[model samples]
Target: MKDQITHLPDNADRSVAKQKFKITNWPTYNKALINRGSITFWLDDEAIQAWYESATPSSRGRPQRYSDLAITTVLVIKRVFRLTLRAAQGFIDSIFTLMNVPLRCPDYTSVSKRAKSVNVSFKTFTRGEIAHLVIDSTGLKVFGEGEWKVKKTRQRTPSYMAKVASGS
Candidate 1:
């Protein structure tokens, strides 16, 4: 039966071959790498024109100063940059000043109050191409006493690890 043996006796031959990939388009690859770390800011003319309230005055409370579109636009900038309401206000104001767009930015209070009613629409970054997303998570022990303290205190509680990811 030894002569008819069909399987290898060792796992050395069962190992998978390492994959080798070639980057054929160096210019595109380099541009993509550079863009990964780049930040872009854009403001269209239509947004500038519709910055202030255009609707007829309501027969109720004080008339609104900024339009819903303006509030939504500022809120979106806040979310994207992870900035405070005040900071977002200043940031947008700076952008307008630099672009020479004579549009008034909504204050933090106005933006916050209008946020409850404004329908903010966030657009996905897709250029008519299939986007492949890769997500990796790592758990980290953030809070808790040391192991020696736990042993001495006789309080062996389960530790909770926090998972943080990039671009999250």
Candidate 2:
């Protein structure tokens, strides 16, 4: 079963207290997530030096384990599997020893924020009819804004909380 976040503390204070993330019955979620993961085609910046030079240096100091290739691999796995951040986090953290990833898996926020930074453009592959050749494109979209409809309405659906977090 997937996780669902129905409501959140709209104005939760950060420094006042902390709510740690934990996953119980992790064996099942671990198997579920990993079984769903796959290593398919990948897109990466080939020119590492050039790519690094293009971005501003972080003030936090030298690169950390967070920058390791294994992390990127897992990020791709998460993407290919289309798992949410929490699912990935729980899944990976539960099986760190088994997978032997260098760093303990990052929490959902870290994984989601880092991967979500890759919103620049998308690369697509399409094939033309009656030909062996294929077409590739990126950043494809149709956009419209400032539109409203009175007849169309939105409704919220009810959801049951998963017992994994023990009702936190």
Candidate 3:
């Protein structure tokens, strides 16, 4: 069957569309935005105490300076920002110094090693109520030769579309 695709209007203005939607809870939304912008690198006293009271290594290896909680925190930050291990290490170090936390920050190597066996669990936020989430995506227009032309000239499958076509 022929593709039943319809193109969007060329005159559509994103700014105008955005202006149409009004925020109901501006204060709550603003607070959430501000909180999201502020990164909490240092753990509170209760968290640090809990980490200290937890299990310790029984094996006769090098004693770790930073606890599992600290390492896990670094790993989570790394994952959220899509940073390299080295970059994550630098980030944690900077944050620690800025916050004036007297805790030892783990090296990138230690974070990498500990991350292999770390169990990061996220708590469920729903209070026995069904929640719905909506996600929208838009395609980016690439400024290059069209796929058909490139494929014909190169006499090979285009790399961009190869994965979907070949299941790779």
User: Each model's TM-score, in the order given?
Assistant: 0.52, 0.31, 0.46
Off by over 4 Å in 2: 1-65, 68-71, 100-102, 116-168
Better candidate number, 1 or 3, judged by lDDT: 1
The lDDT for every candidate, in the order shown, is: 0.59, 0.38, 0.50
Q: How accurate is candidate 1 locally (lDDT)?
A: 0.59
What are the runs in model 1 whose C-alpha is more than 4 Å off? 1-34, 121-168
Query: Judged by TM-score, which candidate is best?
Result: 1
- What lDDT is reached at residue 130 by model 3? 16
Better of 2 and 3 by TM-score: 3
Each candidate's number of clashing pairs is 0, 0, 0
Best by lDDT: 1
Query: What order do candidates take by TM-score, descending?
Result: 1, 3, 2
Q: Cα miss at 162, model 2 (Å)?
A: 30
lDDT winner between candidates 1 and 2:
1
* Pick by TM-score: 1 or 2, better one: 1
Consecutive 10-residue window with the lowest summed lDDT within model 2: 159-168
